[model samples]
Target: MPKLKVIAFDGTEFDLEAESGSTVMENAIKNAVPGIEAECGGACACATCHVYVDPAWSEKVGQPDVMEEDMLDFAYETKPNSRLSCQIKMSDELDGLIVRVPEQQA
Candidate 1:
């Protein structure tokens, strides 16, 4: 399992354990992390699971695909590091992946 760190809008941090190959949004929902609405599950059809990949981890996380990029337009406070958590798969390389939840979802 990879250890993921999720920072809530209010700056609360959650240290979560996530299975490799699972989506970030999945782990978040499973752990009851707030602000990741994931309204469309992991289908990449909604922007509710919006998060900001910590700058230091942005390159490792990579940029979103066309579909995810389009959907992010609907997210709240989209930033240079904004990403749809459902599109980010967990891996050992992401063991310390850090993301910050937006104050609100789409």
Candidate 2:
């Protein structure tokens, strides 16, 4: 399992042990982390699961794909580091991944 840290808008931090191959959004939802809505499940159809990938992990986590980049147009306050949580699959290389929830979803 990989460890994940989700920082909420109100400053809540959710530390989770995530299963490999599952998504960051999945862990957040399963752990009841306060901020990931995952409205479209893991379909990559909505921006409700938006988050900011921590600067430290940005290079490894990488950028969103073309389809995801389009969907991010609807996310609130997107930045250079913005990513749809549902698109971030877990793996040992990504252990200790950190992300911050936006103030609100799209």
lDDT, each prediction: 0.95, 0.94
Candidate 1 local Cα displacement, residue 62, angstroms: 0.4
TM-score each candidate: 0.98, 0.98
Residues 1-106, candidate 2: write the lDDT tens digits.
8999999999999999999999999999998887789889989999999999999999999999999999999999999999999999999999999999998897
**Which consecutive 10 residues in model 2 have the weakest lDDT in total?**
33-42
**lDDT by residue (tens digit), candidate 1, 1-106:** 8999999999999999999999999999998999988989889999999999999999999999999999999998999999999999999999999999998999
**Full-model lDDT, candidate 2:** 0.94
Residue 59 in model 2: shift from native, Å? 0.3
In candidate 1, the residue pairs with backbone N, CA or C atoms under 3 Å apart (3 or more residues apart, or in different chains) clash, namely none
